[model samples]
Target: MAAPAAKQQGFYDCRDAWARTIEELAENDPRIVAVVNDSVGSSKLGGFQKKFPDRLVNVGIAEQNMVGVGAGLANGGRIPFVSAASCFLTGRALEQVKADIAYAGFNVKLVGQSSGVAYGELGPTHHSIEDFAWLRPLSNIKVVVPADSWETAEAVKWAAAYEGPVYIRLSRMPVPDLVVENRKFQPGKAETVRKGDDVTIIACGTMVHLAVQAAVELEAEGISARVLNMATISPLDEAAISAAASETGAIVTVEEANIHGGLGGAVAEHTSANLPVPIERMGFPGFVPTGSVEWLFDHFGLTATGIARSARKAIGRKRG
Candidate 1:
């Protein structure tokens, strides 16, 4: 048997980073403001409201109009960060996101908080599994799922400074930090967390931690896996995907969204014609199950066991 894999230091929630970015950015640029649908507390914006009370616009329980209003704010030369639960922001105002923010090319940044199964006991209505499929089709909108607090802060800062529509996802679940404080946010670049040759593991958001764990477990099996924390889905790191496929010969893609059009689909889309290789996509299969978040993750094969199994399958599928 192979030796046990190494461990990281500690975990942190990206939501705190979101709040920090909001406060710091708003301090610098007066145009940087927040617009929530009565989600100041839920989205962890209470501190933000306290810090910049006049900069926040809370529209209670209205998602569609909330997005439109955000667009209007952007059109009026203000940087509006629309914060809300992902299930409501993406599902409720998907069309408005497409037309108002993306199609119109506004400078609105959509912050999807408590994404995936973060609201464990809140049921399926609170789950955000369709955001990938919903936003991936639209052009001009960058899709970002920061893996840790550092990445979250950097992505938000980058999105705010850069002009255009961007979707930045913030998770409430505790996650170990990945990049350093000096890590720069490149629009479509992939961050390599672990290097290997047997197989490559590509993941975004909370799935990134699982991929790191899977790398450790695979190391015990004498299997090497290259782990890439792919935070951007819309503008994929094609070079990294191609390199992973070419160097490792196999790839396993993971995400919290559905397997249909999320990071997995983006990887498959790139590898299809550029550098074809054995690929396995792991994520929600679109079936809302009745169980705890941990149970739901296990149900969808998102655990470390599931990720290792999928990595093994991908390695096995590699053509000699």
Candidate 2:
């Protein structure tokens, strides 16, 4: 059996990548502005504020008003990147997102920093696990979760130029580089990380690397598992999901979100209609426990070992 996939030697924070990309994009496009809710530090936009003082609009802890300001900026022909904590950004400003941004088709880039359980120590109140569930149902809004720093930078660049509303979910947690530095990011495409036959593991954001590691572990136990990075949650890679169902025979989905309405739910919706297959979804099952991020992930079965376990169970269901 092959050994586990080689782990990356260093770590990188996606927020740093987002900040750098935003600054670079601002250099080229004068229309790029950042709207924040008194979260300049948390969003890692200090440098941006210094460089583009007038461009950084801090709305002073008003999440809903921040979204309104962003929409207004868009109305004035400026591209606004609304950056703030995921919980407040999505939960407090959801109506603005739905009506002003999505319904109006404003070209606003909603940047949810420190998403998922990246704030695990702060408990469920700080967790943005429900953002995906909340945003995916809205029309005219593209939901994206970048797996690592490279993907985060690329996604931010893409969102800057895209002509419609986009929500980019990012984490403060450090993750190994996933995509190549210069690989062009496609909004609705899924990247195949590893190929196998017995089962398929579809994951997004931070779960992508873990899914790849899980495939390696399953290989050691004589299970062939295909791993796919389903980065774009809203415009899901339907063709890829369909092919995985037809070829792999079984499917397991991993996410750092609720199982009901995130990556797992999206995959289930696709496969159920296009091609029925045995499936297992792994994510936070309920209100999460209070602990460090690492502890919470292990506690909720969001680790590589746990993913492999789910993959094996999915294979068993396929055989049964």
Candidate 3:
């Protein structure tokens, strides 16, 4: 993946992809509707509202009620997207999500907009470092954190068509296109952006771009680092993970979420028991730090420089 000599003129925010998917899906399938907690604007749905005013259901600031309404809508034959900030959507209405959505298997799409540290200056209370940890344990639900605009758009299409509960964390951070244009997003499968035998860099969400950059850096240093964008967190791509471990011998897992019970924990559990290769997990150490999202990411060591350094350390350890 070569960095553009000049930053490309066409970088799509993942939110654009979300709104695009909603508009396209709604055009064909009238069942596709959006339900939010008075966050239609912040969640980037003004266009959606203009297109489908009646279909846009705003349940005010009450998170729990917002989700319950979504579940009811699903039961009534409408495909509802329960969209909200990740901190509020997953944290505030966890019970509603568990009982009304997951347990009931409602075809409600939970779009977590502005997730992770995208809340930036709002502090830890607004950060969503624990979403993966909270959602991964739930049964009968799919958790996805797409790596880039292509993955994000495809994931949205997949969730809209699939007849089950799903949670998608849409980051506020801008992303370049990954995978070919409109690539097929396979649920429960990891996409190997780069293949190598030295080490495997397993990452998802915003950290995936950093992982790919790290692999490029490693390549320049004569290290063969494979890059796996593990988009599906729950019902994780364990098979791809095991293959990376058995084939590559060393692995580095990265995420914008907490290192515990997110991408790292899932891969560690699989690799430690089955493949048992050396692993270095690069992510938040449980506490959600206070600062701008960029500052917190740098502070927590998830920038491209940080991931590269961690990959170097992991490769060294594996050689020993």
Candidate 4:
């Protein structure tokens, strides 16, 4: 079945929400400090710096040192939000993140900005597709990928109040707010955007809206496709995944990151152990070729049509 055309809506850059929410939190609490790798402009924390100059620390292109400084700040009772380009923040400073924050159990918020392919033509060297795979194994750190501006703000708020290590992945891509009634941000829980009986399309980060559109397309073709906004990747909503596998019988996992050791892998690991079901994983295979962000998404089948196609394939694989 062909995927239905997407309806246009107001788009938002989630980094703006992250910056605004953190500034608001800082206004109330003196302990809220932002540490960056000279990424005040990219992380959209310029306003934060202007409002609280003394609190915003720029580590000057040193990703590892920035993370270490964040850990030190946490040790001193300051809630430090380490912000940097996701590529460098996760790849260049992975050991610091695993050791200083995860293993040490610091009260730090690692904010990975411009995550995924938001870097566009900068190529795979700048793309952050490997971040989830790198950070997911660090059991102590909570991994979060917010779908839109609302979730981004909510995740920031939640991470601030929770005294533990957290990695909130944010993107500069413009996305429309999800249409969810009485929305509440519950970390490690899947938000059922659309209910169904045949198949479930689970997605995170920027791919969630595309999954919702795919579900709409499937509904028109008499295939009920449930859509889940899996904002939190690590410590996955296993209960929701189990119910989807038991009731829907088929699952399609999508993300803007690699299919390996990401949201798809998390869901697959759970379902494979508990409720065996037909599953289709969608995302980049590995190092993607250089292209515009739009091209990368379409080329890698991360769009509505692509997700709908995978949904059908998973449905076809279901045991009768």
Top TM-score hit = 4
Give each model's clash number: 0, 0, 0, 0
**Model 1, span 218-288: residue lDDT tens:** 99999998899898988788899989988999999999888898889889998998989989999887757
Q: Each model's C-alpha lDDT?
A: 0.87, 0.89, 0.86, 0.92
TM-score preference between candidates 2 and 3, better one: 2
- Selected candidate, larger TM-score, 2 vs 4: 4
lDDT of 4 by residue, 1-320 (tens): 11212334698889889988999999999999999988999888999999999999998999999999999999999999999999999999999999999999999999998888888788888889999999999999999999999999999999999999999999888889999998999999999999899999999999998999998888899999999999999888999999999999999999999899999999999999999999999988899987888888999899999999999999999887
lDDT of 2 by residue, 168-196 (tens): 99987778876433456788998888888
Residue-level lDDT tens digits of model 3 in 1-320: 11112334655568888888788999999998999988987788999999899999998999999999999999999999889988999999999999999999999999998887777777778888899989988968999999887788889999999999999999878777765433568998998888899999999988888888888888898988999988999898889988998898889999888888888999999888888988999888876655776678888888888888888888788755
**How does candidate 2 score on lDDT?**
0.89
Q: After superposition, how far is residue 215 of candidate 1 from its true place, in Å?
A: 0.8
Candidate 2 minimal-lDDT segment of 10 residues: 1-10
Where in model 1 is the C-alpha error above 4 Å?
1-9, 179-182
Error of 3 at 171 (Å): 0.3
Q: Per-candidate TM vs. native?
A: 0.94, 0.95, 0.94, 0.97
Q: Sort every candidate by TM-score, greatest first.
A: 4, 2, 3, 1
Q: Which stretches of candidate 4 lie over 4 Å from their true place?
A: 1-9
